[model samples]
Target: DAGVTQSPTHLIKTRGQQVTLRCSPISGHKSVSWYQQVLGQGPQFIFQYYEKEERGRGNFPDRFSARQFPNYSSELNVNALLLGDSALYLCASSPTAVYGYTFGSGTRLTVV
Candidate 1:
Protein backbone atom coordinates (compact mmCIF):
# COMPACT_ATOMS: atom_id res chain seq x y z
CA ASP A 1 0.00 0.00 0.00
CA ALA A 2 1.54 3.26 -1.06
CA GLY A 3 1.49 5.95 1.59
CA VAL A 4 0.79 9.61 1.02
CA THR A 5 2.93 11.32 -1.63
CA GLN A 6 3.64 15.01 -2.34
CA SER A 7 5.23 16.61 -5.35
CA PRO A 8 7.94 19.23 -5.83
CA THR A 9 9.94 18.25 -2.75
CA HIS A 10 11.31 21.78 -2.96
CA LEU A 11 10.08 25.00 -4.50
CA ILE A 12 11.21 28.61 -4.91
CA LYS A 13 8.80 31.49 -5.37
CA THR A 14 8.72 35.26 -5.18
CA ARG A 15 6.44 37.25 -2.95
CA GLY A 16 2.94 37.78 -4.43
CA GLN A 17 3.23 34.74 -6.67
CA GLN A 18 0.89 31.76 -6.33
CA VAL A 19 1.83 28.11 -5.91
CA THR A 20 0.02 24.85 -6.06
CA LEU A 21 1.17 21.75 -4.18
CA ARG A 22 -0.09 18.28 -4.89
CA CYS A 23 -0.75 15.14 -2.84
CA SER A 24 -1.95 11.59 -3.34
CA PRO A 25 -3.29 9.58 -0.43
CA ILE A 26 -2.80 5.95 0.32
CA SER A 27 -4.88 3.30 -1.34
CA GLY A 28 -8.48 3.03 -0.17
CA HIS A 29 -8.23 6.13 2.01
CA LYS A 30 -10.75 8.92 1.70
CA SER A 31 -9.52 11.79 3.83
CA VAL A 32 -6.81 14.29 2.94
CA SER A 33 -5.61 17.22 5.02
CA TRP A 34 -3.16 20.04 4.31
CA TYR A 35 -0.79 21.49 6.89
CA GLN A 36 1.89 24.13 6.87
CA GLN A 37 5.05 23.79 8.94
CA VAL A 38 7.21 26.80 9.45
CA LEU A 39 10.83 26.58 10.47
CA GLY A 40 11.14 25.43 14.09
CA GLN A 41 7.41 24.88 14.40
CA GLY A 42 4.91 22.08 14.25
CA PRO A 43 2.55 21.54 11.37
CA GLN A 44 -0.43 23.89 11.32
CA PHE A 45 -3.60 22.45 9.87
CA ILE A 46 -4.95 24.26 6.80
CA PHE A 47 -7.80 22.14 5.55
CA GLN A 48 -9.33 18.68 5.81
CA TYR A 49 -11.54 17.05 3.23
CA TYR A 50 -13.39 13.75 3.33
CA GLU A 51 -15.28 12.31 0.43
CA LYS A 52 -14.60 15.50 -1.48
CA GLU A 53 -16.39 17.56 1.18
CA GLU A 54 -14.56 19.80 3.59
CA ARG A 55 -14.65 18.35 7.06
CA GLY A 56 -12.57 20.90 8.92
CA ARG A 57 -10.21 23.85 8.56
CA GLY A 58 -7.66 25.62 10.67
CA ASN A 59 -6.97 29.28 11.44
CA PHE A 60 -4.96 29.99 8.31
CA PRO A 61 -5.75 33.00 6.16
CA ASP A 62 -7.88 32.90 3.01
CA ARG A 63 -4.73 32.76 0.93
CA PHE A 64 -4.45 29.15 2.02
CA SER A 65 -6.96 26.90 0.37
CA ALA A 66 -7.24 23.23 -0.68
CA ARG A 67 -9.48 20.61 -2.17
CA GLN A 68 -9.61 16.82 -2.40
CA PHE A 69 -10.59 14.91 -5.50
CA PRO A 70 -12.65 11.79 -5.95
CA ASN A 71 -9.52 9.69 -6.26
CA TYR A 72 -8.44 10.86 -2.81
CA SER A 73 -5.72 13.07 -4.19
CA SER A 74 -5.49 16.72 -3.12
CA GLU A 75 -4.03 20.09 -4.02
CA LEU A 76 -3.20 23.07 -1.84
CA ASN A 77 -3.21 26.56 -3.34
CA VAL A 78 -1.56 29.56 -1.81
CA ASN A 79 -2.21 33.02 -3.25
CA ALA A 80 -0.14 36.17 -2.89
CA LEU A 81 2.52 34.11 -1.22
CA LEU A 82 4.67 35.92 1.26
CA LEU A 83 8.08 35.31 2.73
CA GLY A 84 6.34 34.04 5.84
CA ASP A 85 4.60 31.56 3.56
CA SER A 86 7.90 29.93 2.90
CA ALA A 87 7.54 26.66 4.78
CA LEU A 88 6.99 22.97 4.44
CA TYR A 89 3.55 22.14 3.12
CA LEU A 90 2.57 18.73 4.42
CA CYS A 91 -0.12 16.41 3.19
CA ALA A 92 -1.69 13.95 5.59
CA SER A 93 -4.36 11.35 5.19
CA SER A 94 -6.26 8.64 7.04
CA PRO A 95 -8.95 6.14 6.38
CA THR A 96 -12.45 7.46 6.19
CA ALA A 97 -13.19 6.18 9.68
CA VAL A 98 -9.78 6.01 11.33
CA TYR A 99 -7.98 8.25 13.76
CA GLY A 100 -4.23 8.11 13.24
CA TYR A 101 -2.87 10.14 10.31
CA THR A 102 -0.08 9.53 7.80
CA PHE A 103 1.94 12.47 6.49
CA GLY A 104 3.96 13.02 3.35
CA SER A 105 7.50 14.35 3.29
CA GLY A 106 6.08 17.67 2.08
CA THR A 107 6.89 20.38 -0.44
CA ARG A 108 9.40 22.85 0.89
CA LEU A 109 8.41 26.31 -0.34
CA THR A 110 10.88 29.15 -0.17
CA VAL A 111 9.43 32.57 -0.90
CA VAL A 112 11.96 35.27 -1.49
Candidate 2:
Protein backbone atom coordinates (compact mmCIF):
# COMPACT_ATOMS: atom_id res chain seq x y z
CA ASP A 1 0.00 0.00 0.00
CA ALA A 2 1.09 3.54 -0.65
CA GLY A 3 1.99 5.83 2.19
CA VAL A 4 0.11 8.98 3.05
CA THR A 5 0.63 11.57 0.34
CA GLN A 6 0.45 15.37 0.31
CA SER A 7 0.29 17.57 -2.73
CA PRO A 8 2.20 20.73 -3.68
CA THR A 9 5.27 19.71 -1.67
CA HIS A 10 6.01 23.42 -1.48
CA LEU A 11 3.85 26.53 -1.70
CA ILE A 12 4.18 30.27 -1.48
CA LYS A 13 1.50 32.76 -0.62
CA THR A 14 1.08 36.30 0.52
CA ARG A 15 -0.44 37.44 3.76
CA GLY A 16 -4.23 37.64 3.66
CA GLN A 17 -4.46 35.11 0.88
CA GLN A 18 -6.15 31.75 1.16
CA VAL A 19 -4.53 28.42 0.40
CA THR A 20 -5.56 24.82 0.28
CA LEU A 21 -3.48 21.76 1.02
CA ARG A 22 -4.42 18.24 0.11
CA CYS A 23 -3.66 14.80 1.49
CA SER A 24 -4.48 11.22 0.59
CA PRO A 25 -4.33 8.58 3.28
CA ILE A 26 -3.06 5.08 2.80
CA SER A 27 -5.50 2.50 1.49
CA GLY A 28 -7.79 0.73 3.95
CA HIS A 29 -6.73 3.11 6.70
CA LYS A 30 -9.29 5.04 8.62
CA SER A 31 -7.20 8.12 9.08
CA VAL A 32 -6.98 10.06 12.29
CA SER A 33 -5.13 12.83 10.58
CA TRP A 34 -3.36 15.54 12.31
CA TYR A 35 -0.61 19.17 12.17
CA GLN A 36 1.91 21.75 11.39
CA GLN A 37 5.58 21.68 12.33
CA VAL A 38 7.74 24.74 12.64
CA LEU A 39 11.44 24.63 11.90
CA GLY A 40 12.53 23.95 15.47
CA GLN A 41 9.40 22.81 17.20
CA GLY A 42 7.46 19.60 17.33
CA PRO A 43 4.31 19.23 15.29
CA GLN A 44 1.18 20.97 16.52
CA PHE A 45 -2.09 19.12 16.41
CA ILE A 46 -4.48 20.96 14.15
CA PHE A 47 -7.40 18.68 13.45
CA GLN A 48 -8.37 15.04 13.22
CA TYR A 49 -11.01 13.80 10.79
CA TYR A 50 -12.23 10.28 11.26
CA GLU A 51 -14.98 8.62 9.25
CA LYS A 52 -15.43 11.90 7.35
CA GLU A 53 -16.20 13.92 10.44
CA GLU A 54 -14.03 16.15 12.53
CA ARG A 55 -13.04 14.44 15.76
CA GLY A 56 -10.60 16.95 17.24
CA ARG A 57 -9.06 20.36 16.72
CA GLY A 58 -6.21 22.19 18.36
CA ASN A 59 -5.76 25.79 19.52
CA PHE A 60 -5.49 27.21 16.07
CA PRO A 61 -7.54 30.23 15.06
CA ASP A 62 -10.73 30.09 13.05
CA ARG A 63 -8.82 30.78 9.89
CA PHE A 64 -7.93 27.13 9.75
CA SER A 65 -10.40 24.53 8.58
CA ALA A 66 -10.17 20.99 7.30
CA ARG A 67 -12.32 18.19 5.96
CA GLN A 68 -12.03 14.56 4.98
CA PHE A 69 -13.52 13.24 1.77
CA PRO A 70 -15.51 10.04 1.39
CA ASN A 71 -12.44 8.41 -0.02
CA TYR A 72 -10.44 9.15 3.16
CA SER A 73 -8.53 11.97 1.55
CA SER A 74 -8.32 15.29 3.38
CA GLU A 75 -7.82 18.98 2.72
CA LEU A 76 -6.71 21.80 4.96
CA ASN A 77 -7.71 25.32 4.10
CA VAL A 78 -6.41 28.51 5.57
CA ASN A 79 -8.07 31.85 5.03
CA ALA A 80 -6.57 35.24 5.78
CA LEU A 81 -3.19 33.62 5.92
CA LEU A 82 -0.59 35.18 8.11
CA LEU A 83 3.17 35.06 8.01
CA GLY A 84 3.14 32.95 11.13
CA ASP A 85 1.22 30.35 9.20
CA SER A 86 4.31 29.50 7.24
CA ALA A 87 5.43 26.05 8.28
CA LEU A 88 5.64 22.48 7.22
CA TYR A 89 2.08 21.23 7.27
CA LEU A 90 2.20 17.52 7.98
CA CYS A 91 -0.41 14.88 7.20
CA ALA A 92 -0.54 11.82 9.43
CA SER A 93 -2.70 8.75 9.13
CA SER A 94 -3.35 5.79 11.41
CA PRO A 95 -5.67 2.83 11.43
CA THR A 96 -6.95 3.80 14.84
CA ALA A 97 -6.85 6.91 16.96
CA VAL A 98 -4.18 5.58 19.30
CA TYR A 99 -2.13 3.68 16.79
CA GLY A 100 1.18 4.80 15.34
CA TYR A 101 0.85 7.13 12.35
CA THR A 102 2.37 7.18 8.93
CA PHE A 103 3.24 10.75 8.05
CA GLY A 104 3.58 12.51 4.74
CA SER A 105 6.62 14.62 3.92
CA GLY A 106 4.43 17.69 4.32
CA THR A 107 3.64 20.81 2.34
CA ARG A 108 6.14 23.54 3.04
CA LEU A 109 4.09 26.71 3.02
CA THR A 110 5.84 30.04 2.91
CA VAL A 111 3.89 33.20 3.49
CA VAL A 112 5.52 36.24 2.05
Candidate 2 lDDT by residue in tens digits, 1-112:
7899999899999999999999998887777576999999999999998888898999999999999998989999999999999999999998876577999999999999
TM-score quality measure for candidate 1:
0.96
Off by over 4 Å in 2: none
1-112 per-residue lDDT for model 1 (tens digits):
7789999899999999999999999888899988899999999988999999899989989988888887989999999999999999999999863476899999999999
Q: What range of 10 consecutive residues in model 2 has the weakest lDDT sum?
A: 25-34
**RMSD in angstroms, candidate 2?**
0.8
User: What are the models' TM-scores?
Assistant: 0.96, 0.97
RMSD of 1: 1.0
